[model samples]
Structure formats: structure tokens, C-alpha cells
Target: MVHEPRSQTGLSRNSDTEEIVALAELDPESWSAILAPRLAYFAAVARAEHVTRAAHQLQAPQSTVSRALVRLERDLGVDLFARHGRTVSLTAAGRTFLATVERALGEVERAAESVRADADPESGKVAFGFLHTMGSETVPSLIREFRADHPRVRFTLVQNYGEWMLEHLRSGELDLCLTSPVPDAPDLVARRLDEQRLRLVVPEDHRLATRKRIRLAEAADETFIMLEPGYGLRRITDDLCAEAGFRPRIAFEGEEAETLRGLVAVGLGVALLPPPAVPRKGVVELTVTGQRAVREIGVAWLKDHPDTPPVAAFKRFLLTRKGRLLSFSPAGV
Candidate 1:
């Protein structure tokens, strides 16, 4: 099968167009020469079709503009303009090449603007990742407190499982994450955030609903409603059950913790869950008395990643608010 070269508009550019594109890639030094001189002079002349007018708009001399266009053509090994007396017009090759160079220059401008935004002290952005479980109350409360002081600071919030969030942290897509099992990667700097107590949630008519506190062994036979596997909370539930000498027989598995709580409320099965900020109706929270009935949550970021002002401010804010939640960090930091 024969494959033809395609341009930005998805149209076949034939041999000459392919040569133009290849020149930009095969000889990067030449491409860099075109870039190092800045494409503004070429772009102005291309847009106006007159070197003298382009020089006037640029406040540069006509000779300088002419020299720049000649240099750009010479470096790229393509004729970008056809001159007739004082004015110039784009050739077939010139139109195709200009299309590529305009887009490249536009991206360079956008990149500059984005870096400037990231560097601005008062109004920069932070890409924050946290567990789906923390999205309802814990994360919002913290963000509200932080925004009270830095009102213009922006956030890009991502909520996912610990494993997925950690991947984003490593890829530089996320500045920081609130996650559990506090991944032990050498590339990450993880600070113990808080440890949440897990409660054994029983339906209203279940055999053990009347009990205030029960060791996990008592529910050895009960079916469990739990978050799906690969979740940090699910790992804790499974570990707690294992320590109690039983593997959980799952009744229902779901993405949301509240949905699992709702299933328990309807008497589908009992679940091991963290207490809701507001207790859900029709379910009773039983304290799980055991050694492994808690999950560790921590803040992790790529090691040596320099934080922008907003990211630094929010990290400090999170570190300082130690007593706001019922949970406490094992290391207290």
C-alpha cells in the first residue's frame, strides 16, 4: 500500500510539501536558525505581501526584513516568497511552509504565556489530586480555608484511586495528591497526612446492629458491601478481614463509598466504611475493634518538583491544620 504525506488540513501535500516538512525535521540546526531569528519578520511580510510595509509595521528597515526573508528561505532550502519589484507573493511551497511555521510560532507564544501564568505569585494554578472519598467534605473544606487567603489562586482538581493518582503525580500532571497506602515509591516524597478509622456498618435488622462495638471476627459469616478492588479503602477492608481470619464474601461492589453505604442501609449486606460526615439513615455504625481497621492517607508529590506559589501555599496550609479532622497523622505531619 502507498501512503501519501498529509498536511495539517488532512490534504495530500505531494512531493514538494513532503520535502518542506522533512527539511524542518531532518536538519534541526537549519530549523533552529529560522527559529532563533524569530519568525515575526517573515510572518509580517507574508501577511502584508510587501517587505516595505512589513518593515514599517515592525519599525525595522526594509533591508533587514528582506534579509530575514532571504535567510529564512536559505536556511529551510525553500522559496517562501516570489518577489516582483517592491511587493512579494507566496509560492505553492511558500503557502504550505508558512502554514506550518505560523502554527509553530503560535505554540511558542502560548507556551511563553503559560509559563508566565505558572510563575505569577498571586494568580498561579495548582493541579491537585485526591481520593474520590475525600472529594465530598475533606477536600472542599481545605480548599475553602486556603482560598480565604489566596482568593485568586486557581486549582485543577482530580479525584481518583491512590494507584491512579500516584501515576499522575509521577507524570508531572499533578502537583500533589492526597492518597492512601501512601505509596512507597523512591521518586515520591510522601508526608503522613491522616489516618481514618473504619467502622463496621450494619443494616438496621442485622444480627449485630444492636451492638455498639464488635470485633471483626463476630461478622465472619456476613456478606460485605465494599468499594471495588484496587481502591485503598478496599485494601484496608480486605486486610482487616484477613487479620480476623476470614476472607470477605463480597455481596456488592461499587465505585462510590456512599453507594456502598446505601446498599448497607437497604440491608443488602454489611460494609466496612469510614463514618460519613453526616451519618446515613437506616444504617448503624459499629466501631471495629481490631489492629488493622484504619487506612493511612498521605500527601505525596514528585521528589524535587519545585512548587509554584499556589502549590507551596496550599501545601503549607495542609501541613498546619492538624486538629481540624477527627483523624490524626501517625507521624503528626
Candidate 2:
């Protein structure tokens, strides 16, 4: 697109026309072919501060490095360096341009590494991230079951909270993740594997220990042991308490669900938690009656990412286990 400069009378200037024509002739691809190698040359020269030493470091001739830098300055319309005898120093413009060039080089290197990693189908790796709660049982079971088929497939597992895990998924650090209260994002492909019911656990000798089923509001006055603020369980706890028409009085906050269970076992405070795979001693699990007392666990991956062999296999294995959730799953969510 060309914009002809116009005066108040709408007459075009000849000087502006010539400038636009010259600008139009500057093809970006051709210029980049000329600029890319020069950027490397500039970086080397900036580092060494001496043309001869910079050329030696790059294993190139001194004349070649010097000529490239001169042409680069001409093309960019900036004074990149000031030479005093054999020593060189970067101009203000040179420092700013080097910062951008370094970032561009890093991105290129990462792209190349990713492409090479993707090309290897044999003995490939899957970066599988998941929730801390699922790491103990659900995740392990899924991996073991999946690996039975693809024995050579490797895994890099990460355990993190709900939204945090999704960040890893988007960045391509994780091929897939299992998270609770599945995150809603336009860029993510999420499938609800199943919903696992969370039970209200109390110490064996507590007043509500004998009750197999109870309403959440019934224990409004009790001090609740909750996961810290960012956790998916904590969000569910707050929502469930809100549904019950009261805010829980938090007695303790911790990172892991098992730690919260431990706190409950000693009578420190009662907690609303997922039923442990093997019920921890000294704590009794009870069903919460009103509203749903379940968290929806699901797998998520970036919609734009091309799945590797291991990632695709693992994902298919997970989908097959849709209705077959963990051992503690109740009749309904």
C-alpha cells in the first residue's frame, strides 16, 4: 500500500512520491537475508570490541566481519558502532538493536530444538502435568496403564494447581494436564474424564463421625481445614460453603490435600476433601447432601499444538477411562 503525500489543495508532492517508491522497493525478505548474518557479526564485534578478535572468535576473516557491519549500518540507517583505532564501542542504537536480535535468535533456537524433538517418534517423551491431589493415585494409575502398551514412551510429569497447570499447557511445556474444575479457555481442548466426589472428613471421635451423610451447613460453625487460596479445592470449598449460605471459618491452610487430612485426624480441624484412595486412619469420610459435593476432573491440552506419538497415545488412554474414575468415586457427582 502506497500513501501519496498531499498538501491542503490535494496536490501530491514529487519528493514524497519518490520516497514511497524507494520504500516499496525495500523487500523485507531480501533485506532480512542481508540483515540476519550481519546481526550475528554485530553481536560478535560488540562482545570483542576489536574487529580482528571478533573475526577470530567467529573463525571468519576481519574484512568480512567489518564489511558486513558497515552494510548493516547502512541498511538500518543507524550508527551501530564508533571505532577509535583498533577498538570499537557500541553506539546507543547498537545496544537497543542487540537486545532485540538476541531475543530473536533465542526464539529461532527454541523453534529448531522443538522441531527436532517432535521428529523422533521412537522412545519419545510426553510432558504430562497434573494436579497435586491426583499425583498420588489417579495420575500414577493412568501412566502405568498407558505405559503397558507403549513401554518405551517416557514421561515428564509436573504437579500443580488448576489454572497454573493450564499455563504450562499453553507454553508447550506440557503436552497434557489433568486438572479439577477444568479451565475454560478458547485456546485449550478440554475433556471431562469424570467427576470425583469430595467427602467431609472428621476425626473418629468427633460429633458427626457416625453420620454417613450430612448437610454442609450443619457444620457451619466448625473450623475448616482448607487448601491455600489458589487451589481448585479451595475454590470448591468456598463455593460449597456459599451454597450452604455461610462462609467457612478456616482454621488451617496447607498445600496438599493429604496434609489437610492429617490435620483433621488429630482433631485440629475438620475438612472437606476428596476421599483418600486408602482411607487414612483416624478420619471418617461422610457425604455432603445439598448441591453437588463433587469436583470435575478433566484433561486439557493446547488446541494449536501438534500432539507427539506419546502424547496422543496417553490422551487416548485417558479418554477410554472416562467413566472409570478413581476408586473413591461415588454413584453421582
Candidate 3:
């Protein structure tokens, strides 16, 4: 089938106006050279229809604008404008090209604007990790309030435990973290948020459940249901028992706080836990003494990266909000 190029000027309209055209397809590199540079210039020239006027607006010489048009025509292998006396006018092709050029420029501007906003502290994605204890009580409220203030920024929460969180924070896999204080590692900066006591979780009906507080020495002989090894809570529980001069008898081990609480609820055994938050429906909290057992829940990140614009903004938000809730870190200049 024979096909002819469509004309943009009304003067060139014919029966072949709807024919398939090769000028419609352009390679990426060719498109960059022909359509990217001086695109605004083309729109300006197309609008004014005068070389000197377009040149004045572009802050370029008339010849420079003419040369850019020549390059564009060469790239497309078609005449875009026609020379009429000393002025130029759009050819059939120039009119079609102008529409596409204007649309593309608008899209590019929108993309640039989005990138700028995401790079700003007030807007972006904040990837963070936190411990389950804080996840239940503190982190959720912090996130809700932060979102309310800065709706453009997004928060992604990762639930993690122990030193694995520290590893992820330092390696850049995590942007920020909330965890109980671990042994200080070089280059890892932390803000101690609050101290929470480790309490014995047992069913409300259990014999020792009536006690407000008991020495860790008293529970040394009881079988303890605990989180698996490596959780910060488990380590604290194990360390407290060791400090009391006996290892806890492990009846069962699990991961979720609710599960461990449930095991304790059934009178299976008591488990050492962070200070109770939800009340566990039927569980009771017994404070332990002697060990003076408490863990510092803090916001931790790599020292160097903590000061980055987005990270710093989030740190400030967390610190300010945390201070109002329960003072956590020492503020330093």
C-alpha cells in the first residue's frame, strides 16, 4: 500500500493526510539532540513567528536561533518552518512538532519538581527499623504524629531485634533504628530514649501474681518462657538471671511477645518482659529487683549518616516527640 506524509499546514491538506509516516518514529539519542535542546526556543519561535523576536526572548543571536532550527530540521530530515521574506513561518510539520514539544517539556518539568521535593527534608521516604516493644507503644504514635505534620514524607517500619538491627543500620540497609542499647560500636551513634524495667509476666491468677515487686532471686528457681536467643529482651532476661546467680529454666522459647505472654497466661511459665503496655487481657506484671534490670530504648543510626538532611529531619522529629512522651536522649549541640 502506498502512503504519503500528512501536512500540518491547511494549504497542504490532501486525500493522503492520514497515511502512516516514518517521521513519527524517533530513536532516543536522536530525540535527545533534536527535541531536547532549544525545545523552549522552538516553542518561542513557533509562537512569535519572528527570528529577531524569538532570539531576543532566548537571549541568543538571530543566527544562533536559525542554526538551531537548521539542526532540528536536519535531525528530523524535514523542513519545519518556511522562510517568508525576512521572517519564518511554521510549515505543516512545525505545527505538529510544537504540540509534542510543549507536552514533553511540561512532563520534564513535573519530573524535576518531584525529585526536588523528595530530596528535601520535608518530603521523602524514611526507611527505619525498631524493636517490638517500642513498636507496640511508642513507634506507632510517633509515626502517626509525624505523618500528620508532614504528609509528603513516608515512613517504612522494619521490626528487628538485637545486634542484627545494629548491623543493618551501619550497613546502610536501614535508615534509622529503635532498639535497646547494645554495646557501643565505633561509628554507631545512639540517642537513649527511655529506660524500661524488665518484669516477670504471669497469669493474673498465679500465686506470685499478687506481688507488686519481687527480687530477681525469688524467681531464680522458676521455669521461664522466653523469646528465642538473640532478641534484646531475651538477652536482658538471661543476663538478669545470671546476675541473680542461676540460669532461668527454659520451658519454651518463641518470638512474638503475644505468644510468650500467652504461654505465661496458661500457667505454662513466667517470662521476663519489657514493662507491660496492653495489659495482655489476663496477664500480670511483677517488677523484679536486685538485678535492677532495665534496658535503654534508643534511636540508633550510623553517626555519619545521621546528620543527612532526611535522616536528620526524622531524628529531630523523633527526638522532639519523644521528649514530650518520655524523655529519651541527652540533647547536645
Best-fitting candidate, scored by lDDT: 2
State every prediction's TM-score relative to the real structure: 0.79, 0.67, 0.62
Cα lDDT of model 2 by residue, 48-89, tens digit: 888889899999987787767766776687878776767888
lDDT of 3 by residue, 210-267 (tens): 8998888788778889989888888888788888889889999998777898888888
lDDT of 3 at 146: 71
Candidate 2, residue 34: Cα displacement in angstroms equals 4.7
lDDT of 1 by residue, 215-252 (tens): 99999899999888899888888888999999989989
Off by over 4 Å in 3: 1-117, 306-308, 321-333
User: Per-model C-alpha lDDT, please?
Assistant: 0.80, 0.82, 0.74
Q: Model 3 residue 119 lDDT?
A: 58
Question: Which candidate, 1 or 3, has the higher lDDT?
Answer: 1
Cα lDDT for residue 49, candidate 2: 83
Q: Give the lowest summed-lDDT range of ten residues in model 1.
A: 324-333
Clash count of each predicted structure: 0, 0, 3
